[model samples]
Target: MNYQLNINWPDFIKNYWQKRPLLIKQGFTNFIDPISANDLAGLAMEDEVDSRLVSFQNGSWNVTHGPFDSYDQLAKTGWSLLVQAVNHWHYPSTALIAPFRVLSDWRIDDLMVSYSVPAGGVGPHIDQYDVFIIQGLGRRHWRVGEKIALKQHCPHPDLLQVEPFAAIIDKQLEPGDILYIPPGFPHEGYSIETSLNYSVGFRSPTSRELFSSFADYLIANDLGNYHYSDPDIATRDNPAMILPTELTEIQHIMQQLLAQPHIFNHWFGTFISQSRHELDIAPPEPSYTVEQVIQLLCQGNTLYKLNGLRTLNVADQYFVNGEQLISPKLNITAINILCEKQEIHADMLGNALNDKDFMQLVTKLINDGYWYFND
Candidate 1:
């Protein structure tokens, strides 16, 4: 189920990607919903799924976390149900994200779907990441304000909303329209009737987050082991005061850790390749033998990477689900092919299948639940 997304990539990237908001009519022509409202509600009931219910009544906003037992408490209107990372659990919905692969795969977050009844909304707010909100089953009226600084306040402990903003673009969205909103732009949407909106969110890691992850990496690898030692002893009247030279030396030591490209790249590759949400991974019940896997491929069975599993490469080094693939003793090109594509066939493996080391690695990946065969 490959969806057709009509857009001029070069033009959109140049003019509107992060610069402003753009409403693309018929972005997904004759769009058919991959999941229904009832199915979405079913997902919310699962203990592992991250979901929330937001409702506004009597001029107050309320929010509750889910694994909810019932929706009987929900108000007739002015309420919405949101479930995160639908693509990881629903196979049909994964196709909706395939068309957006024109952008970097590592930057993608997940597919969040929300269902709203008449007059339902989450209120005006700003996000720190870019998102593409596609209208699904019914109509929704949306208002998008320009990217600007605005004061935000939390109505509910879990929800933060912005003050009123002047809309730059306001319109009614039908089944196939898309609303692209960049970071820091204020926007709000409400249902004209019962509707579903699929939001494809992208990640933008902040400096604080990067530094924190790097610090953890440093600790894990026992890096930054250098101890400061000044051979020269200086006598100053104020010995308690920390000298500027000592401060500079401390900063220099920290910078040295970041200057090592090998260390930094390994940490980043492993870090970014990790999925933020849980993946639907099921190892084969009986396990697979190398010979059996080879026979299946020869019989024209295709190998499909698990949905929401991140497989990426940094030069010849490849990573999947936070662990680096052992490649020094294996065929590098074959590893690249596996990392580069979502699916592969026997011919795609070429001579790699003949190499025992490569086959051993592939067998481990399959057994570990990172990759599987399509039945």
Candidate 2:
């Protein structure tokens, strides 16, 4: 999990990152996978896991639902099994996400693992998010090209394909090698051998998505009460027809919402913390009352820590599970460490639990499996 940034981090962020794609050679050397292929397949069997099997047969693309029985059937030819959010389901695979912490943790998306057969590929496609594809067991030949017009690119129902272009970078990635691709770049990879690829992606929300999410957040928070109105009266024969002034007013309202102070930070933090689907968590068999939980903390019987949860501390506020907890007294250092560090040490829970409301909050988190304590 120790990542050494070869290139100047700040310079790359300011210059190339997202503006273009750059492949880092041996980004992680001697990196050992925490989970094996069998383990990954076991995870795919879970009902909560989102998985798909994509294969190229008879010169066409085919996809199937997974919880696959085995990869042996598809091992010889072109096929791949992809599982999303592997970190949420398996602790071992979660280590794959650790190296990218050099960048902002808030921007780090889920880790997607794909197991492919020899010569397997998903075809040339443009991704919306920045991704680092790390080779695990075998080799993968990757061809990457610069961003081009979608009109020039041909599309398939199952895959977004582009006309073949000369690869700016054509290379075979071996074990521990990494290929980083920024958004809008047309790239493709074919497995040279039976292989597993780990994709660590970064979040990149579109302008429309951002505006819509901000509006949703405003509605949820009961903020931005301004109703749309056009002072200039305009009547049309068709009442259902929308007027241009009304359209202008709506646009103004959107702009006003975007201008609010600390709005982006608030919205982004909440959006990131909120899980798209419920995480797999096993709460304590017998839940304790809030008072009992508080008493346990006071008595030092157990240590309470956030369970498989990532939190964001923004502007003296703590956010998790779309809920915000603000406290000037809460140690920023402790909060940062809690967010970054996988586990909270026994000592760190003392001050946080002293506040009755905070203690109750923590207790609720425990009951909800967002936090847990050991006896």
Candidate 3:
């Protein structure tokens, strides 16, 4: 089932987006759940999928990772199962992400679905990423606390949670209800009955992630070859002691690398466009010819982007999945369709077919399972 969301995009962004928690009752009118509890359980058993089963019984919390062979031992109640990146495998869940494109594209993460029995929930926790939890199937009582530094604990290695904070907003969410929580807001949802919830999460890299990835990029590319040398040698009382000036110089070197906006932009463009989760990419067995692709386009068929493949448009450059596609000889208007539209229309192809580079790039992407004809 597809949801026709009723959202005030400008107002939502101006007021509540990333600033605070929001609850939109009946966000989707006459809404129908797209996936079921059985579907979620089935997905949790897949090897490539990220999944977990959480249960709290008799004041003891148990956490288990999957590919679960069986869930027969899990209690009928007090257990919740979560499957990550559902959008990558399930086409219907992907539709739930479209309305949120009003926000930044690179920030968009994957859809995670959860199934819970009555009174079941993962403990109170804080997420660094922003998320919208859409209630489906049945009711869930949700509580969101203040966005502050709360003390966290780990009962199990896999589960990290905060002590229950005072909820600023507490409500029972029914099917079609949407609750938006920004980063660092401690939140928890307990099932009132058997239920399903869809979380659309958005990611922002941490300083540590950026630092480590940038260093790796430098190593892989053999960049930053400049050696540090101080013409003015500092005299120290002890030969073993490092000088303050030298420390400052070392810090400045790293800062310079970070300050190069162009290099950072290129690295980030590739980094953000690739999913942390596995993508459903399997290149075509028999490659489609350029003439065949052109014929399909000429026949007025649209090409849909593969699910979970990220695309970004920065100036004339188009970054798809992880590689960069320099815009065809044509201007930005033609190439903009690559990032802006899910389906690349025939009209948008325009004169790009005349260019070998554009045709080759398109064929390569098609063969790589990044894009496909609507037929």
Sort order, TM-score high to low = 1, 3, 2
lDDT tens per residue, model 1, 1-375: 778998999999999998999999999998999999999999999887889998898999999899899998777789999999998888788888888978988888899999999988899999899999999999999999988899999998999999999999899999989999999899999999999999999989999988999999989989878999888756789979888888888899988888888988898888888999888888987889999888898899999888888887775568898899984495878888888778889999988889888888888899999889976
Q: Model 2 off-target regions past 4 Å?
A: 1-8, 69-75, 150-156, 218-225, 228-251, 262-268, 288-308, 326-333, 349-357, 373-375
lDDT of 3 by residue, 1-375 (tens): 556888898898899988999999999877788887888899899998999999999899999999998988988789899999999888778888888887878888999999999988998999988899999989999999998888999987889999979999999999999999998899999999999999999988998998888888888878898799999998888999998899999999888887897777777777777788998787776889888888888888888888877888654457887777763453455556666777786778778756667777778889888988755
- What TM-score, over all chains together, does every model reach? 0.95, 0.83, 0.92
RMSD of 3: 2.2
User: Better model by TM-score, 1 or 2?
Assistant: 1
Which stretches of candidate 1 lie above 4 Å from their native place? none
Say which prediction, candidate 1 or candidate 3, comes out ahead on lDDT: 1
**What lDDT score is found at residue 344 in candidate 1?**
86
Best by TM-score: 1
Tens digits of per-residue lDDT for model 2 on 72-149?
576468888888888887766666776577887667878888888898888888888899898888889999997877
| lDDT for each candidate structure | 0.90, 0.74, 0.85
| Of 2 and 3, the candidate ranking higher by lDDT | 3
In model 2, which residue pairs have backbone atoms overlapping below 3 Å?
A: none
